[model samples]
Target chain A: MPYSSTIAGTRYTFPDLRTLLACASPPRAGDRLAGLAAETAEERVAARMALADLPLKIFLEEPLIPYEQDEVTRLIMDTHDAAAFAPVASMSVGAFRDYLLSDAATTESLRDLAPGLTPEMAAAVSKLMRNQDLIAVAKKISVVTRFRTTIGLPGRLSVRLQPNHPTDDLGGIGASILDGLLYGCGDACIGINPATDSAARVMALLQSIEDLRLRFSIPIQSCVLSHVTTTLDVIAKGAPVDLVFQSIAGSEAANRAFGVDLALLDEAHAAVQNLGRGPDGANLMYFETGQGAALSAEAHHGVDQQTMEARAYAVARRYHPLLVNTVVGFIGPEYLYDGKEIIRAGLEDHFCGKLLGLPMGVDVCYTNHAEADQDDMDNLLTLLGVAGCTYIMGVPGADDIMLGYQSTSYHDALYIRSVLGLKPAPEFEDWLTAMGIMDAAARIRPVTGETQKLLAALP
Target chain B: MTSAPPDDDPFAFLRAKTKARVALGRCGDGLPTTRLLEFQRDHARARDAVHAALDVPVLSAELVATGLPVPIIVQSLAPDRATFLQRPDLGRRLEESSSAKLEKGDYDVSLVLADGLSATAAQKQGAALCALIGKSLSFRCAPPVIACGARVALGDEIAARLGAHLVIVLIGERPGLSSTQSLGAYITFAPKPGVTWDAERNCVSNIGPEGLPLAEAARRIVAMTALAFGIGATGTMLKEDDALAMLEGPGNSSPIDGHRDLQG
Candidate 1:
C-alpha cells in the first residue's frame, strides 16, 4: 500500500505506527492492522498530513514480548537454551542499554536475538560466545538462579586484606591480617604477595592463611598472589586454593611475559570452579593489572594505554575473578607520572572494567619517588567509591613492605564506607556483627571478649 | 664564546640538556600518553636491572677480554636474592669458602666488581672501566674479583686480603627509570673490613652512556684513586671539585652539576 507517513523508511498509513516502530521494533498486523495500512495513494498522502496534526505519542503499547517473570525465563531458555544469560553479559554498557531501551526492547526478546544467542542443534543451534561474554552472562543469568553469592552486587562493597611481608614471616604477616580483619576488612579476600618468588614459599604462606581461616572460622576466601601456574601447582599438591592469582596485561605478549595465557587461565578457572569456597560458591581467580603493561611487554601494537587496560579485562572476565584490581600507582611514575595521571588512569580503569561486568578495585597507591601522596589517593578512593568500586587493598598504615610502596590503609576503607554509606558484603558484615568487632554502622568498636580471644589464639 | 643559549622551547631545551624527568609536555590532564608509556617502560627496565642475576662466568670472560686476567669469582655471605634483600649486613662480608679462597698478595690497588642492586649496571660498565683505569695509570693492580650478591663493604675484605694499599669497588647503583645500567665506583684507601665508614669513602656515581660517559668515568676513577694515594685519606677528606675543575676547566658543567653545586 502506498503510504506517506513513515518510520525507518517503511511507510505506514496510520500515525500510530510511527510510535509502534520506534518503541517495539516491528509491529505485527495487530488486532487493528487493516486500519493502519492504506491501499490507496490519496489515503496514504492524507495519513501523512493527519500524522503531523496528531499529538506526539509515547510508545507505551504492549512491551516487545508480553510475558510474566517465569515466562520470560522460559522464553529465554527456549531461545538460548541453558545459556540464555549470554545475551547481555559481555555487551558494553551503551550496547546493553540500547538493547533494553530500543524499539525491539524487553528482556526476553533481546535474549532471544542477542549477539551470542544460543540454540540447541541437531535440529537446534549451538551457542559459542567469547569467554568474557560467557562470564558476564553468568552474572546476568545468575539473577534468576543467583548461583554466585560473593561481592560486587548492587549497593555492596568488599575489602581485601593485603598483609604483604618481605620475609613471609607467619607471625608478623598474621598480625597484619588480624588487624585488617578486626577493622572490618576481609570481605573480598586475604591475599598475600610473598617477597620471595619461590613456589614453595607461596604454598606455605597460602597454607598458613588457610590454617588461620580454619581456626578463626573466618568465612572469607584466601589467595597467594603468585603466578597462576604456581597456584595451580600448589593446588595440585593438595593445598586449599580458593582462588588462583595472576598479574594480567592487555596483550598476548604481555600475558606471556607475565607467564599466563588463555589456556592457563581456563585451567586455573576450572581448577577452582568446584572448590565451593566463599559464601556464594567459589570465584576461581583474582587478577591484578596496571596500564602500560602491554607497552612494557612491547605488545601494545600502538593501542592507547587505557584501551589496552580494557582488553586486559576481556582476559580477566573469563575466570570470574572474586577480585580484579588495577594496581593504579604501583608500576611507578614512568607510566602514570603524577597524581593527576594516576588518578585519571585509576578512574578510567574502574569505569571500563565495571562496564565490562568485572568486580573492580583500585590499589589507591603510590611510590616514594612519584610526585604523588596520600591526598591524591584520598581523592581517587572517594571518586572510586562514588563510581561503585567493588573493593580496595587494606595494608597496615597503607604501607606494603614487599612492594616498597604505600596503598589504601584500613582507615581509608572505613572512611570511604562511612562517607558513602556503603556496607561490606552481607556475609562479611554478618560475621563482623557476630564477632562484635564492628557496630551495625560498620564502625570499629572495642574488641569484645570473644574477638579478643580469637585474636589471642593466633600463634 | 658562551655555548649556544638554551633552546627557546622549554621541552626541547630540557630534553636536550638533561636526562632528568622534566619539561615532559602535558596533554589534556597529565603527561602526554607517549611520555607516560615511556616512563612505564623505563620503570620496568629499572626493575629488571635490579633483579637481574649476575652472570659471573660471562663477566669474568668479559674482564679477561679487556686484557685484565680472569676475575676470581666469589659470593657474599647472603645465599640468594631473597636473603640479600633482607639481610644487608650479610652481603657486606665474604662467605667462608670465598674467604678460604682468598690469600694475601702485595698490590697497590685492588679492583672488586660487585653486583649491588643492579647486575645490569655492573656487567655493562665494570670490565671496560677496569681496562680504562688500568691502562691510564701504572699501579700494582691485583687480579680483579667478581662478587655476587655483594655490597660496597665487601670491597674492603677483598682489598685487605690482597694486601693492597687502595680498594676500588666498581658496583651497581640502585637503578632509576631513566638510567637502569648506570654504575657506581667507591674508592677507599687503607682498606680493611669494619675499619672504613661511609665518611671514609669516595664515590663516583652515575657512570654510564647517559650519565658520565664511560671514558670520563674511567678518568675520574683513576684521578680519585691517585688523589687518595697522594693524600693520606679519602671520603669527605677527598672531593671531586678539584678533579672536575681540572678536567673540564672553568664554566664547563656536567649533567649532574646542579646537584654538585647544591651539595657545595
Candidate 2:
C-alpha cells in the first residue's frame, strides 16, 4: 500500500514500505549515493510523519523484501513470537516509540519483547528516536552473553583487545596484546584481524594467542578474525579456536557477496561447538557488521543502509553470538560521510542489536579520509558507554596500523570506564585484581611486578 | 614476582616490535600531553595528505628523466576531491575529455598513477616505480597516465581505451597515522571498464619506507604481472605464493630509494 503525509501544505508520497523507510531515514552519504534518500529536508520530515502513523502490523502484513526471495525475510517471519508481541501489537510506530521510552519498558520487559520485534519494527521506531531516546531505551535493555567471561552485565563494559599487525608477526601482535593486558583491557576477547587469509598463518596466530592465554591463565577468549572457511579448516586440524568469525550482511545476496551463507555459518557454529572451546557458555560466534556492507556489494535490494544493518542483527542473534559489533566508520566517507553520521549509526546499531537480544558493541572508529577525528570517536565512545554498550575495541593507542584506521584506544577504554563507573566482566575483573593490574575501583594501577612478568613472558 | 625499577621505561623495547602506537604513557586514564599532541600531529598529517594535490609537472619531469615516456595527464569523472571522496562510483570512470585523449593501440601494459585518497603518496613514489617496471617488462609499455580524483579501478577504463593486455595502477593508499604517504599497486589482466570487480585485481599494498620498500614492491609487482600474463588471470585465481620463489631470488637496487625520506 502507498503511504503519504502532508506537512506545511506540501504532500509527500511513498509507493511502498521500503521506500517509506528509506525516505524517512536521516541523511547519510550511502543512502544518497544509492539514490534512496529523501530529496528534500521537508520531504524527509513528511516521510517520517507518515512512517510514525504506520501500524506495527503493517510490517508483518507487507514484507520489505519478499519472504520467498530473501532468506533473511523468511527467517524473521518464521521465528517471530506472536505471543510476546501481543502487548503492543496494535500500536503505531510512533506510539511504540513512546511505549519504549515510557516506564513500562523495563529491562525484563524489553528482553521478553525482543523475540516479538522485527528488524523493520526496531528500525522504524529508531527513526523517530533522537540520540537520547536511542540511548535511554538501550540502557534499559540488558542482553547478556558469555564465553570465557560474562559480557553485557549491568554497570559493566568490555573491550576487545585488537592487536592487529600488518604482517601478522607474532612478536608485534604479542607486544600489543601485552600492552592491552597491563591496562586491564581484553575482557570481551583478544581478537586479531590477520593480514593474510592463509590457513597456516591463521593457525600460527591462534596458537600464539592460546599460548599467551595459558601462560597468564587470563580469563579471556581469543579469536583470529579470518574467513569462516579458513577457521573451519583450522578447527578441523585440532587448533584451539574459541570463536568462529564472519562478516555477515542483511540480505542473502550481500552475504553471498561476502562468501558466506546461513548453512555455512551453521556448519561453522557446529564445528566450533564440537571443539568444546567455550566452557563458560555456548555463544561461540563473533560477527563484525557495518551499515554500508550490503550497499557496497550492490545487494541491498533498494533498502536503506540502516535498515539493512538492523536486519544483519537478526542473522547474528540466530547463532547467539558472544559479540556483535558495528564497524560504523570503517567503510569510509562513501557511506557515513563524517563524524555526525558515524555517531548516529553507532548508536542506532547498538540500540537495535541490544533490543533484538544480542550483545552489541561499537567499533567507534573512522578512516583518515573520512571527515572525522579522535574527538568524534571520543564523543561516540562516551555516548555508547552511557548507553551501556556491550564492548568497544581497544587498539594500541587507537591506531590500527594494519587496518589503516583509527579506533578507540586502550586509554580511551580506561577513560570511559573511569568516568562511567563501569567495570570489566566479573571473571576478568577478578583476574585483573589478582594480577594487580587494576585496583578495586576499576582504575588501572601503575604497571608493577605482575605486569612486568607479562611483558617479560612475551616471545 | 620481582618489581622493576621505576626509572626504567619497560615499554621502550616494544616500540621497535610494531608500528602500532603502544606503551604511550597515560595521565590518569588519558593520554599524557606529549603523547596526545603526538597523536594529534600524526592525525593532522594524515588528514592533510588526503587533500594534498598531486604535483603533476614535477612527477612528469621525474618520469621523463628516468627514461619513461612523457605522461598523459587525465582526471576521472569526479570533478573535485570532495566528490571523489563521497562518490566512489564516479571516480572509477574516466571523464569524457580525458577519455578522448587515448587512441586504441596494441600495448602490452598500461601503467596508471592515481592520486587516490593521498596524492602525497602518488607524488612521492609514482614516477620512479613506473620507470622501474616500464623499463624492466621486456614488452611494449604505454605512456604512463597520471589520474587526478582517481580510484584504483580507473586504470581499467584507461587501459581498455589503450587496448593494453594488462593494467597496473600505482595509486596512493588511504593515509594512516603511521604512514601518510604509502602507495599501493593493483594489477588486473584483460582490463575492461564496468566489467571488472575489485576481487579480479591483485593488490600489493603498504609500499613506503617503513613498510614494504621500493625494490621489494617492484619485484612483487613485476612477478605478479608476469604470473598474470602466464596464467591468463589475476585476482583470486592468481596467487602471490606462486611468485614467491622469484621474489626471493635477487634484489635489484631501486632508483626510487631517494624518495623514501620525502615525508620527513
Candidate 3:
C-alpha cells in the first residue's frame, strides 16, 4: 500500500517497485487482474499519484493535425473512387474523409476520366511492375520491430499540431497534403498525435520542423508521448522529444493482432530520467502494434512480427533508446486478414527481438484499399526493399496509387503487372513521368487530359 | 429475437454474426444503474431525452445505439491518498474547459470525453458518450463537439482540429476493484492533431456493463471504422475477429465472451 504520492503540486514515484514485488507474481484479486504482480520492471510501479486537485493545463486534444478546416478541405480534393479515398464498405463509412476534401477531387475534368493510360490504368501499372519479384527466393528474414520513424509518416498525410500545429504553414495545407508527409517519407519519418498537440503545440511543431528539416535534410525521428504526456512534457521541456510508450490500443481494435505490453519500460524510464541532456537525448520507448487500429502500422505502431521480443525487452528495461517496429499491411481487405501473416508476425518479432535488446522494424502500407491492387501497391513496396525492414511508412498519394487509377478490374488493373516482375509497371504514364505529373508519354495510353489529372491523385 | 440492428461490422466481428446477441454477460446498455443515477439529476439530459421524445438524436451512429466510440478514462479513483500519490503526471490531460467547451467543432466525426485512468469512467460515459456520439454523427455533422480535458492523444489532437476522419476516444478506462466504469476506445483513422499511437491505432473495448456491449460496442465502432479505412492499418491486427477466430478452427480454445479475457 505504499507506491508513492504527493497531491497538491505533483509528486508520484515508482522508483522500481520494491525490486519488482520480490520477483513478483500476485495480483489477481477482485475480477481477475489481467497483469500486475511485479516480479520486476521494478515491481510494476503500479500507482503513482498527485492530482493537485486535478486539471492543470491538461486539455489533452487540440491540433496541429485533427482535421476540420473543412475536413482538411475535403481530403484535399479527393477524386471519385478507390473506395472514395481509402475506405471501403458500410456504404463507404463516414464518407472517405469527405471524399478526399471534395470539390470533385480538385477538378480539371479529373484529367479526362483519368487512370492516365486508361488501357485499364496501364494494365494496373503493368501488373505492379511485374509483381516486383515476390518472396524473393524465400530469403524470409521475416520479423522486426523495436522502433523506427524518428518522426513523420503513415501517408498521403499526417499532421496533428498544437505545438502551434493549427492549419497553415501558410495554408494550401502545406503545399498540398503536409508536403507529401515531409517529402514522401523515405525516412524523414513522421507521426506525432500524442493526444492532438500542445507542449506549446509540440514545441511549435518541432520549431516549425527545423524549417522543413533544413529544406528537407530529413532527420526527424522520435515523438510519441503519454506515460504522463511524454513524462510531463519531458519534465516541462528542457527539450529533447523522442518518446514511444505502449498498449497497442487493444492490439489495434479488438485483436486484429499486434500485442505486447511491458508497461513500456516504466513509461520510458520516466521519460528518459525526467528529460536527459545526454544519453543520446532519449529515443527508445518502442513496442507498438497493429492490424488496423487506425490505419495499420505507423511512424511507430507498425507492429506484428509477434510479441516483438517481449516487446523489445519491455522497452529495453527502462529505455536505453531501443528501436523496433513491424510495419506491415497492404490495401485494406478482400476479407479475413493476413497481409502476409501480419508481415510474418512483424518480421518474427523484430528477428527474435533484436537478439534481446529489440530492433526489428519493417512497416509498409501505401494504402487506398477499397479492394487494393497495383499488385497491392508494388508487392507492399517490394516488401520494403526485400524485407530488411529497418523502416518504411507510406501514403503520398498512395491508396494503391488510387486503386491503379480506378481500373474496371482487368484483375484489378493487371495486379501489379503480374506481381512485380514488371515488363510492365509504371502506368498513369510512369506516374506522370515520376511526378512531373505528366509529359514523358511515348505511347503510354490515357493521355486524355494531363494524364488523367495525375491518375486522380493516387489514393 | 427482437432485433434488427447491431451488426455494424468491426471488420473483425464475431458475437455470432449478430442478432443483437445479448443473453447478459453484460447487456445493460440504455443507461441503467438506476437510470445512471437518474441521468445525473437530469436537465437537458442524454440524447436530450430521447431526442425530445423522438424528434431524433436519441443516439444514432447506429449499431442499435453508438458503441464504437468507447472512451471511459476517468482517473481519480482514490486520490486524496495524500496529494494523490505525488500527482501521477496529473493523469495525462484534461482539466476545466469541460466537454472541451462543448466544441461544436469543425466536425467530421469526433467523440471525446476524458478523465483517463478512471474518474469513475468519467462519470460513466462522460455526459452520455458525448451525448450519444453527437447524436450519431449528426447526419453528416458539421457541428458535433464535446471535450473535457481529453488525453488519449486528445482525440488525435481534436482530430487535428476536426478535419476528423474517425476519432472515438471516450476516455477513463483505468480503474480496477473489478469495475469502476471500464470503458475504453481510442480509435483513429483520418483524425488529425499529431496522430501517433503507432501501427495506426484502433480499439472498441469493454464499454460498461462489463465490456463490449453498448449495442455490440457500436457495431464494433462502426465495424472498426469501416475496417480502419478498409484495412490500411491499425494495431493488434483485427481482420474480422482474428480471421473468424482463425476460421473457428485450430484447437478452438474458446474463452472470448467478455471481461477482456477475465484479465488474462
User: Which candidate has the highest DockQ of all?
Assistant: 2
Candidate 2 C-alpha lDDT tens digits along B1-264: 233223467787887788888888777898877778888899999999999999989999999999988899999988988888899889898999999998888898999999998899999888878877886687778888999999888899999999999999998878878887788888999988988877788888778875787877887888889888888999889877675555565444322222111110
TM-score, structure 1 vs. true = 0.51
A202-240 per-residue lDDT for model 2 (tens digits): 999999988888988999999999999999999999889
CAPRI grade, predicted model 1: incorrect
lDDT of 1 by residue, A260-377 (tens): 7778888888877756654465566789998767665656544335545665776776666777899988765445666877876776576556544567788998764355667788
Per-candidate Cα lDDT values, in order, are 0.64, 0.89, 0.33
For residues A219-318, could you state the per-residue lDDT of candidate 3 as single tens digits? 3443433344444564467544544444342221222233333343355456555555324443545444432332222211221112211222322323
Cα lDDT for residue B89, model 1? Answer: 60
Q: Give the higher-DockQ candidate: 1 or 2.
A: 2
Off by over 4 Å in 1: A1-149, A274-281, B1-264
lDDT accuracy of residue B8 in candidate 1: 52
* Local distance difference test, candidate 1: 0.64
- Give the alpha carbon lDDT tens digit for every residue of B155-176 in model 3: 5655555465666676554332
Encode model 1's per-residue lDDT on B82-169: one tens digit a residue. 5564345678899989987777888999898888877998888888888888788678998889989888889898888888899888
Which 10-residue window of candidate 1 chain B scores lowest in summed lDDT? B255-264
How much DockQ does model 3 earn? 0.01
Best by TM-score: 2
User: Which structure is stronger by TM-score: 1 or 2?
Assistant: 2
TM-scores for the candidates: 0.51, 0.94, 0.21
| Comparison by lDDT, 1 against 3, better one | 1
